[model samples]
Target: MSVQDAFAAPRSAVRDVNGGTGAITDTVINALKKTRPWVLFLAILGFIGAALTLLVGIAVVISSMMMGNLEGMDAEIAPFGSGMMIGVGVLYAVMAVIYFLSALYLLRYAGAIKRLSSSLSVADLEAALEQQASFWKLIGILVLISIVLTVVMLLAGLGGALFMGAAGL
Candidate 1:
């Protein structure tokens, strides 16, 4: 059958396999609508976190420079601080990239939801869902990486801070 013919509705199956006018589609669309807002909120939060990390890194660098004792500081502690800062910066950059990619995926999903709402064929809906699943998988990987990086950065910062405090620097 031609592509158009495949998308054509099956008259005999108008009532669907079970009872009701395809309420499952409506349910899924509603869920997507509810989820879109949360996704947008998360993206915004990610951006904010990245911005805060950048600001904190800048503050640390400035404070270190102004201390005049930057060169006099313990070499071990200095390396730890520098490494922590660099790790945090890398984490923030990764988070920003993840946020942008996830946002794009969510926006595309939102568009698909709209098309489904407007009575897209089941084939079209299925295709959209397949594409969404791939995007979700990528998003999941990015989120996991971001979490791991953030934790590493946090631990490094804590260790550096403790060392600095103990050394009376």
Candidate 2:
């Protein structure tokens, strides 16, 4: 093929490719309709998982307190006290809340999909996608925070190792 032909598609070809926006939209709508049941399942599972996580966190805190009251425990051997356990439990509870919020967003997305199935409007589809975006955005922010925490913890561990080595401990 000549360089000109290779570099550019004919206008007819371009128009043909660009002309199917409506078809594409219809295809997307159909696919979303087909996936409605799965989305509903996901929303239900997410809510259940969030609730379970919150309950587990609360249980951890309560168990830590009960364990603290037990006798014949060496503080040096078991460094975790009720205070530390409470902190850990609180962290778990916070995580549960974040999970629940994200799950709620997923539920919102599912609801939007249901609405779009009935209305078949671009606005409804956009609203559904927006909820999906919100859920992913929250997850992305949490992942970034986790990466920073991991790096900080690694550095702290390295520093401690160096200190201990230098001190001949």
Candidate 3:
């Protein structure tokens, strides 16, 4: 037999070179979809926490101003600052949970993509690339929103503190 025929025989003997089983891709996609709702919920929660922090900060400033004229009341009114502190604490905790869950989801997604890419034909790989691009875009948006909320909360706390101190409370 010619060398060409020998190579052809071996190629024909093997089957499903492209990993015919679709289980790996399916598992990855399902995992991503499952985690999406949790991430979205966390994003909404973050926004709500930030808003609460801002409102609490504003209230503290206004309250301090109204009570400024009262004598020997500084120690008694100091407990009012607890609201802002609690808000910051809750927001930080929520952000930490979001970060942890997102990291896990991303790792799983990456593994799935790698497996699928290796097992798919050229055409299938191209399609997966497009899907992966969209997925990353969504994750990026979430990350940006999370960061913005954190920054705004921090600034609000700082502003409230400065305002309260200025009021002599």
Candidate 4:
């Protein structure tokens, strides 16, 4: 069948590209149904992780403030006194937000898959896949950002080392 015909085909009428008799759509739906529970568990776990990350960020900020107030602290801890710990905490909070968003997408996908399995609504299936795609897209973007940041940090560190070497320090 042509691409248009394939797109127009009903779920019950859909077949494999090899012209098999079985409905490929049904197979995918069944697989999604089987995976729903696992996705739900992952979503719950991710949410818990995000909450813990946020708590850790808060703790770090508070501890940094306390450390700054302490007398006779080493000069090497100047960054914490200068609010660098707050920056680190904010970074952690941003990561937690990303994790929370990923978890939300997973939860939505699981719910949509469950609904589609019961009623076989094409809209519900589409929604489920859309959520799954969104989750992957978010992860892909974060990975790319992380790679770029790592490269930039590596270059900065190399530059610092070169400068320090030239200064005989």
- Per-prediction TM-score to the true structure, in the order listed: 0.49, 0.77, 0.37, 0.80
Candidate 1 per-residue lDDT over residues 1-169, each given as its tens digit: 6455776866451324224434244556567667756755765665566566566656655554555346687877877776666666565555556656665665566566566656645644665586579678987887797799899999999999999999999
The top-ranked prediction according to lDDT is 4
Put down candidate 4 lDDT per residue, 53-156, tens digits, no spaces. 99998888888777777778777776646489888888889989988998999998899998878767666777889989988998899999999999999999
Better of 1 and 3 by TM-score: 1
User: Lowest-scoring 10 consecutive residues by lDDT in candidate 4?
Assistant: 15-24
lDDT of 4: 0.84
Best by TM-score: 4
Residues 105-149 of candidate 3: C-alpha lDDT, one tens digit per residue:
444445545555455443444555555565577678888997998
Q: Return the candidate ranking by lDDT, descending.
A: 4, 2, 1, 3
Better of 2 and 4 by TM-score: 4
Query: For candidate 3, what is the lDDT?
Result: 0.56
- Which segments of model 3 are wrong by more than 4 Å? 1-75, 121-131, 143-169
Write down the worst ten-residue block by lDDT for model 1.
13-22
lDDT of 2 by residue, 1-169 (tens): 6456666755431211224442225567778888777877877887888888889889989988888887888876444787788888898889888878877887888899898877766678789889889989998999999999999999999999999999999
Regarding TM-score, does 1 or 4 come out ahead?
A: 4
